[model samples]
Target: MDALHAWAWRPDGPAPAMADGPLSGFVLGVKDVIDVAGMPTRCGSPLTAPDPAAADAPAVARLRAAGAVIAGKTRCTEWALNDPAPTISPFDADRTPGGSSAGSAVAVATGGCTATLDTQTAGDVVRPAAYNGVVGLKPTAGWATTAGGRAVAPSIDTLGVLARHVRDAAAVAAAIADGPALFAPPGRAAAPRIGVLRDPFTDRVGDAVRACLARAVRAFSAAGADVHDVSTGVDLAAVHAAHRVITFAECASLHRRRYRDHAERYGPRARELIERGLGTPARDLQEAGAVRRDAAERLGSLLEGLDALLVPAVPEPAPPRATTGDSRLQIPWTLCGLPSLALPAGTAGPLPLGVQLVAARNAEPELIAAAAWCERVLGS
Candidate 1:
C-alpha cells in the first residue's frame, strides 16, 4: 500500500505526472493472496494479522518489471472462505461485492484501479468479477504457481486476473502465465465449436442465469459461432462431493495447529471448516483424492474435440450483503483443475451475471484465445 500510497501521495507516480516512456502505465490491484514485497498479507483474518512480505509474488514482479504500479491489497473473505467482508457493492452498497477477491473486482469496475490480481479455490475470482461486470480469467492450474503467498486449497488454487476487457486480461495473463502459450491465436473457425454442458452442471444454475446463458449463446451464434448444448455424462454431484472433501482436507492441513491451538483467533467459518476437515476420516480424504484425480482425467476425455465448455460461473447474480454469491457453479471444475474464465454476460437487476468458459486441462492458451474472440463477437 505504501507504494500505491506513495504514487498517489507524491508527484513521482504516473497518476500525478506523465510517464517518461512507452508502457501500459496502468495501475493494478493485487489480491491479498499474492505477495507484493513489503506489503502486508492479511488474507482477511484478524488473527493472521498484517505483516510485510519478503518478496513480490512472481506475478507482481513481472508486472512491475513491465511498469505497472501495484494498487494495494483488496478485501477478501477471511482466509478466502465464505466469511463476508466490509466491502459493500459499488452498484448497491446494500449488497455483497462478492469474495474472496471482492475488492479486486470492485476496484476495476469502479475504475479505482485498472486491473487486479485474483485467486480462486472454487469461485473467488470468477464470481466476484461476474458480480462486478468485469472479465476474470483463471488460467490452467499450475500455469502460475502459488510460491509467495497463502494457500487455502492448493490443489485447485490458481492465480487469476481481473480486468475491464479480454485484451487486458490476456495481456496480464501473458505476463503471469507459463510464458504466453507460444503464439496467441484469434478464434478458430467461422463457427467456433462451443459445448454447453447439460445435466448436473446446467441444472443447478438459476433461471435468470439460464436466460443470460441463452443470450450469450445467441450472441456468439449470431456472431458466426456454433453454439450447441451437449451432455458429457459427467456426474457433477459426485464431483462436488469429492471436491468438498479434498479442498477441506487440504485447507485443514494448511490451518492444522493454528485452528486447534489458536482457535479463538480464527474467523468463524474458516475455524469451523478446519475443525470439520480434521474430523473427516482418513479413508474419506483418500477416496476424495482418488475421485478428484479420476475426475480431472475424465474431464479431459469428455472435452475431447471441443474448443470450450460453456456454463454459468455462478448459480445467480450477487445476493444481498448478507453473504457472498454461490460457489457451486464453480466447485466441480476447480476439482478437475481445468482452466475457466468468467465473462460478464449481462445484468440481473442491479447485480451483474456471468458465463464460464471451461477447457480441457492445461489447454488454457486455446481457451483464452476462444474467450478473446467471444468477447469481440459479443462486444462484451
Candidate 2:
C-alpha cells in the first residue's frame, strides 16, 4: 500500500521486520520533529538544517520495540509552531488538515498507516485529528519521554498518538509509556459521568460545532452516561494568552540563536513568534506559569467526580487553507496538561467535527474508557 505523501522523509529499503509484540501488525508514522535513528529531525524548517538523528528518540524506540513498523517521517508546522504544512485534508482538498501534526492525522485518516506519533504543545494533535476526523490522544505531560523530539515549549509539549480508533490510539500510548495494554476493557460497572464545559471558550464555537457536540452529548446520555454542564471558572482568553507567552518564551529559549542568524529561512509565522518570544519579558513568562498552575488546579477540580469533560475539539469545521484553524477550544485544556482524547462526533457540512473527552492528569485509562463508550454510541 502507498503511504500518504505527507512524509518529509522515508526509508530507502523495506522497514525492519515487525518484531513480535502487541503492536506487531501496526504500521506507524513518526512526526518530523521526532528522531527516528537515521532519519533527520527536520522540524519542518529550512533554517534549522539538522543532521540525521544518531538514534531513535526514546518514544520511537519504545514503539519500535513493541513491533510497530516505522512508516516514515510525517510533515509538521515549522518548529511545531503556527506555520502550516503542505498537507491538504482528505475530506476536502480545498481546506487544511490542521498542523503541526497535520501529516500524522492525514496519514491515519487516509489509511496510510495504522497510527502515527504526534506532539502537542498547544493544539497540534487535537486540531489536526478533528479536521481529519480521527482519534488523537495527548497523554498527560511527561507520560511519554521527549528525549529526542525537537523542542517546542518544553514545559507543555507532549508526545501523543493519532489513529482511526480510540483503541488503536490507546494501544500505542500504552506501548510508548510501557504501561499495561489497557486499550479498552469490556464492561465497566456503570456508565461514565462526563462533564460538559459551558464556558466562554466553548461559547466561541460556531453553531455547526455546537450542534455536533450537542448530538454527541445526547448519544452519550442515551448510552447511560451521566452528562452534566460544568464550569472550571477559569477565564478562557487569559489561559490562551498565557499559553502564548509561555510557548513563545520557551520556544525562543530553544531557537533564539538560529532564529537570529537564519531569519530569512524561517516561515513568516515562525519568525513572528520567535520575535514575540525574544521581546517577551521574564516576568510575563513567570506570570503565565502561575496562570498555568491555577488553571490546572481549577480544571482538576472541575473533573473531581466526573469521568471526563466532553467539549468541542475545534471551534468550527476545517476552514480554508489560508490558516490552520483556531486553537481557542483546545488551548485551555492543553495548558492544564490534562489527558485529552479527540474523537469524531459527527459531520458539520462536508467536513467533520470532533469532541474531546478530557480527564485529570494521568487518567488516560478513564479517558479511553469514556471515549470508547462514546465511539460506540455515535456508531449506533
Candidate 3:
C-alpha cells in the first residue's frame, strides 16, 4: 500500500516543474490543516467532516506558482492539537514522529518529500521537526499568508516550512517570504555569535533533549559560532496562560455553531477545549491579547543584542507513537510572534533531536541566513 506516496498532490492542469518556475524540482507536502483544492482533508481526526476545498489555499497557490510538485497532504494531530494521528514514524513505526504537523515533518525526514508546508498553532511545527530531525521554519505571524487554511487557534496559527537540510529550508523560505532575502553562503571565515538556552537544559527539563542540545551547541562553537547564554525576562507562566486563552477562544469561535450542534462528531480533546473556550469571557481574551503584545515586545528586547537565540525545539525526542511529544518549550516563542527556525543538528540516542534559532520580530531573513550559517558550522 504505497502509504507514503503523494495522494491528491498534483496542481490544476499538469504537474508543475520547478525549472519552469523557481521551485521546479522540489517536491512538497502540505499539512492537512490547509486547503488543497481536490483533497479530502481528514486532518487525522475522525471528527472532522470537512468539505472538499473549493479553491487552492492562497499559500498552496503560491507554491504552485513556484513550480513545486505538490505532494499529498501530510498527517497531523487530531484537530491540530493533542490527539495523535495514525501516521507512524518512518525510522521506527513504533515511535511517534511528533505532531500536529506530524506527517509533514516525518515525510521530509524520511525523504518521502523534499519539503513540506507545516502549520503551527503552538509546537506543531518546531516540536515535530525536532523529533523527526528536520528543519522547521515558523515565520512571524502574518508574514506567511493564511488565507484558505483551517483556523485552529487563529491568533497563533503560524505557517511553517519543513525540510531535511537548512539550505533547502532557506530556499523554500525565500520563495515564500515577503521578498528576496540576502543569502550569504554558509561556511563563513569568521564565527557567528550564538546564544545557548540553558534553563531548559539543566535540571529543569528533559535530560536527553538537554544533552543533545549541549552537544549541538558545542559542535556549532567548534565550527566557529560563538555560542553564549541569553535570557528573555518575560514571565513564562503568564505567556503560557495567554497562549491557552487565545488558542481556545479562537477555536471555539471558529466552529461554535457546528460544534455545539453536532457534538458527537468531534473528539474528546476538541470538544473539551471548545467547552473551556466557551467559558472564557471576552474580557479574558482581551487580556490575553494585551499580554501577548507585551510579551512580543519583551522578547524583541531580549533578542535585541543577539544574532539568534538557541533552544531545544521540543522537550525531548519522539515519545511513544501514541503520544505526541510535550510542547512546553515551544509555546512561549510562538506567543511572542518571532521568527524561529529548528535545525536537525543531531540525535538523542534513538529518537532525532533539533535546536531552535530565534530572531527578533520580522527577522526571518536573518533567521534563515543564520540558520544557513549554523548548518555549515554544524556540518550537517
Per-model lDDT:
0.77, 0.85, 0.76
C-alpha lDDT (0 to 100) for residue 295 of candidate 3: 88
lDDT score at residue 302, model 2, on the 0-100 scale: 77
Q: Model 1 scores what on Cα lDDT?
A: 0.77
Instruction: Give the alpha carbon lDDT tens digit for every residue of 8-107 in model 3.
Output: 2344476544556677788988988788888767666665665677777877887777777787787777778777776777767787877788878778
Candidate 2 accuracy as TM-score: 0.96
Return the clash pairs for model 2, or none: none
Candidate 2 vs candidate 3, lDDT winner: 2
Q: Which ten residues in a row have the lowest lDDT in candidate 1?
A: 2-11
Q: How many clashing pairs does model 3 include?
A: 5
lDDT of 2 by residue, 129-217 (tens): 99998999898887878888888889889998999988888888878885664443334435889988888767778899888888888
lDDT of 3: 0.76
After best superposition, candidate 1 residue 172: deviation in angstroms? 0.7
Candidates by lDDT, descending order: 2, 1, 3
Candidate 2 has an lDDT of 0.85
User: How do all models score by TM-score?
Assistant: 0.91, 0.96, 0.91
